[model samples]
Target chain A: MAGNTTPTDFGNPVINWIDKRLPVFTMMQKEYGVFPTPRNFNYLWNFGAIAMVMLMVMIASGLVLAMHYTADTKLSFNVVERIMRDVDYGWLVRYIHMNGASMFFIAVYVHIFRGLYYGSYKQPRELLWILGVLILLLMMATAFMGYVLPWGQMSFWGATVITNLFSAIPLIGDTIVTWLWGGFSVDNPTLTRFFALHFLLPFVILGVVFLHIAALHVSGSNNPLGIEPKSDKDTVPFSPYYTVKDLFGVCVFLIIYAAFVFYAPNYMGHPDNYTPANPMVTPPHIVPEWYFLPFYAILRSFTIDIVIPFTDIIIISSKLGGVLLMFGSIAMMFILPWLDTSPVRSARFRPLYQKFFWLHLAVCITLGFMGAKPPEGIYTVISQICTFLYFAHYLIVLPLLNKYEKPLPLPPSIHEAILAQKK
Target chain B: MGNPHSHGAQCSHDAPQKHGQEECPDNGHDESKRDFIFISAASMAAVGTGVVAWPFVATLGPAKDTLALSTTEIDLSPIQEGQAVTVMWRGKPVFIRRRTAQDIELARKVDGDATAFNSLRDKQKDTDRVKQSTFGGKEMPQWLVMVGVCTHLGCVPMGQKPTDMRGDFDGWFCPCHGSHYDSAGRIRKGPAPHNLAVPTYTFLSENRIRIG
Candidate 1:
């Protein structure tokens, strides 16, 4: 059967004939125009649309930046300078692209948090949430590789530090790192490969995003109340309602993005990255981009080796433990759908779950703050505590909360909830 | 409260009629005027976006200026025996060491099976570390040239400074991760996976060398 089964009746004779044969317009109308969405979605629900807009903005600006970028280690830093100083409007494109990465992450984080608050990851939507997590992983990889293209002090050293992380693996670790670098070190070949993959992976993300949306359409969208649409009265067509809301969201996001691109372009960037890479001089502190700080904190927290009881026989070295914990933080997220045993979908109805959610947010922010600080004196102890809280919130608290917590009574319907709110 | 639902239903009911009336001249004239404004505004935005996107596409091609500076030639005449001079080549540090007779003897006496930690990366013999034993038809065993980056993580070895300790192996030592190399630049201990890499180079003369 054809994918587009909607009626082909465009009023125009020629358009109607074409729709009967090809049906692209029909599919668009069915999928986007008349697609049913719950009416109660709030401003937080707009982040998914905002994220999609940011992705497009990033790709457009990234394409323009790529046209002028030179991936060679020696020339990359200079070419970026040339783009700023010499090329026509290259400064605007580069700034937009540079700032676009931060905006993209910001939008995606909000989108993910929205899903968490509404329990959009529950049962039927598990695959949708999993696809989203995959997109996040791809984004991290893309951002990491994209950072290296400028060949700045941070870019070069960051690649060396992150890629060298593979060496913490057993016997074949060094070999795997070498294979990734395509040589003994991160050189021109590594840059070339990263550039190729960076150029490639956004398209792969776009494909995954397509699947993500298709999956969203199948199950429909979850709302603030976390209740399914039981009747036509509970839902509205996406076009006029969601399309107008999404447009307004995109416009507001663009204003903030434009501010960053124009006024405080380098606010999110490190000053060290302006200098060309010198392998001899390591930066005073090697920190990743601000978005990765929470995980970076987790990596630096494991300064003590795990020894078996009283014996000196090391179960895991500090170095290896750091590597595992850093990766495990993300790996834990992939399993969160299974970890949360709650029958209730929305945190708004679950009072106990809501309290832990706020605490979890605090732990994450604290971890991010600690990540940026030097791992010394009081900072290390705080980081260790925050890291413990982050894991415990997901692994222990979420499972336990699901079993014990009782949820508030739900409204009979969306209309009833709206009427109650009016009182 | 009921007005919103009624408004939505009215629009859905009007949708088929609106599609059917595309070519009709009897439709509201003000609606056509608003449609014209929307079309022009949208077209202008599209054009503006395209204009803004052009420079990024224009500047992405390969650069020719820096590629020309990839090779470097260093003079070895000023370098004394047991001294290593670092030269910049392709934006990396390359070490050119003029070995003393004592250094050469110590390097040659190093046992293959006992000292070499990871010899599999560069299988060349200690004698082969130098480009040619005889350059200009004379013995030139005192010179050893290598890219200065450590095999582990690209840090320059510390023993380039005379005051710096050469580790337990009595040669170049990388303080960053404790990788030690013998006088022949062979990896002998610590975390380095292989020897200091030998770059492609040629002796322009007895005292001159070109490295790419």
Candidate 2:
């Protein structure tokens, strides 16, 4: 089996010597060089490689920013300013790291949507999907902690408000918040620890990314057609074929990222964050980074108290409900492989599922918009509705659709699909 | 043997397997176009990697210059009694107030009417708010020094200016979120979870203060 061993070349003395010991080169050759990939992958498939490249860009830029950044709350803002003005190309690095975070999310969201559309989480690939969700959670933590390192008004208050959410936990809530702060408030100790964790988390993400790819390679890749390669005719060597394709996709992604970094660097960032952290003044509107807007919107949606039916008891406060709902939205994604009960993997073949998939995308984007806006009259009403649909599409819609919807007949193989297209 | 490697026509059906190589169905698709795409792709990847690498190398320079500017000293003589002045110390606002006799009396008066919010947040009393008789320094009950930023979300309070409305307690009122501080810089009311933080400062010969 392709999964068992790499084809080793004993002809070269160095490769022959290494194969006997570690087999590193042989494994690379087998896994990446000539690995069999489905032939008919589309542009959406390119996002996985694009996400990987963006990760590289972020880490490279972040390492430099960390070297120059003073994690002390008193000096963090000043130190970052110095990096922009005094250090050579410090501005460029800071901008890229800042914008790269947005770009990373852009690619990741597309990558996730591609998975959802093609049913990449089905059957043998369930573990691969779980690994991807783990990466998303880690990425979120890394980004949140990284945002606090600047120690601007937004950074300081953002950390305080977000960490304060834990205080909603019943018995040990305040203690947990205190432990997280390492002091009475989000002060020097909090900054120091967040910096340490922020620096350390990317490497942990790198480890999980490795496991994600390993799980992917174990089951081979899902294709646009959402079918297995029945014969050699249905597949191509990964090298020179997908490598060139991925490289092209990565370059295109980089061009967009560079445009943001060089031109509109602060476009995605909040203007109030430029001011140094002052505990006395709060920005009139406190919204998180754009990447977190959707979740933020969901969190804000639960404005009214949930009264238990048949009783006048206000069992769950609106505050606690919002927290649970926000977390539950992300948690639903972790169990998606189970939640989506469709026999046919890809939405392309499933007519009823395909329409709801687009609805899901629209609901998410709407929630993000609502999150960015203050929960006023119309936005509040819309957010509650969108949050409902967002959960329903996954939980209620997908499971029910599995039994009722009739799928279109699939092509025999990837080779035949391409052949039919040519004629 | 010169043409030993020569295979059939370049199509999936014509040559499904040639030696150990598997032929993809789309092999006959434009070769020159693919070459052009690959070249552009390779160049862009190189540029992206190069752009991100420049910052990692430039930050190797020393960042020690900013570290030395952490501690600051302010002249208390210039700040008159019945007035508080905000000073920039280590990138944060430090509120220095030379308290009047009236102000001290108002803060010390027993308040059975309202809650002392600062006591719950900071666990310190009005007497403990000052550097009073601690570290053998001269007890200056008339002088009050605290970080000017509010305990809520880090906005400087409004009571520093005489024209500014000091919330009902006749002290600093945080206009940002309605956190009102007493004459002694203790939290009195509003959403602020604590009092204005008191930074570590000692009187330098009773006319100057050195703060870190």
Candidate 3:
């Protein structure tokens, strides 16, 4: 006790006693307390913390809703309605989950874009960025499954359409689809399994999130300047500085999240989802949620089969092409570090990329807009162009910028930048 | 050569020792025996884990009742000409339409015409689309039976109801992606690559039919 070498130097006797044995307290202090973080973080830096809060909100609310919701094709829809109507504060719990998904995406998309703007995916932090991408994929999967749980018209048709995409594969595609559905079509069995997996996946996301943070801790955070914290002057302890900033950020985010939960709970959801799933009647226009719009646009963009020119043979069917491109769009982010080989970390320093970043973002937003429109006439054409631009941004534009763009001189350090601004 | 389990080997110590550093727990005389124990232990554990994991993985496949395919018996007698009814077959909508005289004539015309039949996405004869069944003691081909789901993305076509929009083909229209099926239930336009699928069925007698 006299020669305590343990880093858990909490003045409290109980924590110190337990820290020597388990060292859990020491870990918290090391990772979240005395952890050195960049002092010059902007509001965008707050989103990672915001996303973490939304995950907990989703899990907690989802757990309570899961207690009341039935996963049967017949009952799942009514059960959700009942939860909104009968179960005590079930509306609140369900609404939180419903809107929490949107908020989570809002935070994560900002978090990811922030990563893109800064070169957070560069070198040592590539693993950290990759882990973040994995979390995004898991979140997408979980959210898709969760959307199906309500068993609404959109839920049924959406599940049917999305699962049927698997059938586009040349061989064993139908077999894979049959296995996924667990029956001839999306029915009770599919609902039950989706429910089971939906419940199981958030925890998986949580596990990956733990790894994301662990990797983040290893590489440390990427600030607005996108430079390493060279000295203590440039760095601030994570406890008071970041903890308070993150808390303030979450509080502001919660107000907006709460406004949606209270004033307009069902605003983010589809009206078609209110009707129970009817296989006999499909929605006039089948579309995915707002978060999935960009990829959905890409999926619909492939209208013609890629055929071998001047030959009878076909390269790939239109459906298969769309599926590949849709998935490829997500895979694009995984290879982004390799794609954008600019030595500069922050886009601010790279004058050309900074401007083109807006163009890429605009293309993505346009794709999302096109996704909501019926895949026809001018919409399909626009979707096709945007889809090309979406892939080309990473594949062609970024690499070209890496080679050609003349970057502005960077401040010596984060502290120097702050001092320079003052002067 | 002290017993490997004892401190004389010194290799298995929790901390590094100044003495007998080379003769650590891993360098014990029973190294071969220890490795055998470790390998067998790991193998058994891996096998045990896999054996335990089988049931959870297997449960995800089609359930026993789902695999037990059921046949749907439709009372087509009540259905009148030009009325299309959807019956649940294997949890999917199976459209059974009592074709009107005009509908039959149009379908037969397409079958007789060489150009139209060749133009079909899935070129099956119109005669092939309908099955011969007895009604009023006459061999008749009045009913057009096919899976109601759209071939593009599995949305049920809208021509089953009197008010719904039947695409120019006068068969059914899938509004989801604007796939137009001619009265023969063949894909005419839009994104759907194939005709509305015809399901296996047999006429029980006259107006009743059984579909799977």
Which candidate has the top score in DockQ?
Answer: 3
TM-score of chain B of each: 0.65, 0.63, 0.71
The collision pairs in model 3 are: B11-B24, B11-B25, B12-B25
lDDT of candidate 2 over A1-423, digit per residue (tens): 335665577699977887767777778788899899999999999999998888888899999988898889789999999999999999999999999999999999999999999999999999999999999999999999999988888898788778877765656976676667765457776788889889999999999999999999999999988989999999999998999999999888888888998989999999888999876555657779999999988876776555687554556655567778989999998999998877688888999889999999999999999888855668888989999999898789988887788899998888998999899
- In the order shown, the candidates' DockQ scores are 0.05, 0.04, 0.49
Candidate 1: regions farther than 4 A off: A1-4, A308-313, B1-212
Q: Which stretches in model 3 have alpha-carbon errors above 4 Å?
A: A1-6, A309-314, B1-56, B100-120, B132-141
lDDT of 1 at A180: 77
* Colliding residue pairs in candidate 2: A278-B154, A279-B153, A279-B154, A279-B155, A280-B150, A280-B154, A280-B155, A281-B154, A281-B155
TM-scores of the models, in the given order? 0.71, 0.69, 0.88
Worst 10 residues of 1 chain A by lDDT: A310-319
For candidate 1, what is the DockQ-based docking class?
Answer: incorrect
Q: Deviation in angstroms for B28 in model 3?
A: 24
Model 2 lDDT tens row, B120-198 = 3334566888867633455788878888766554456778777887887888886544567888887766545457888
Q: Give the per-residue lDDT digits (tens) of candidate 1, residues B96-184.
A: 88888988878777545554422323345778788764676887878888988776655678677688778666778875445678888
Candidate 2, what DockQ?
0.04
RMSD of each: 16.7, 17.8, 5.1
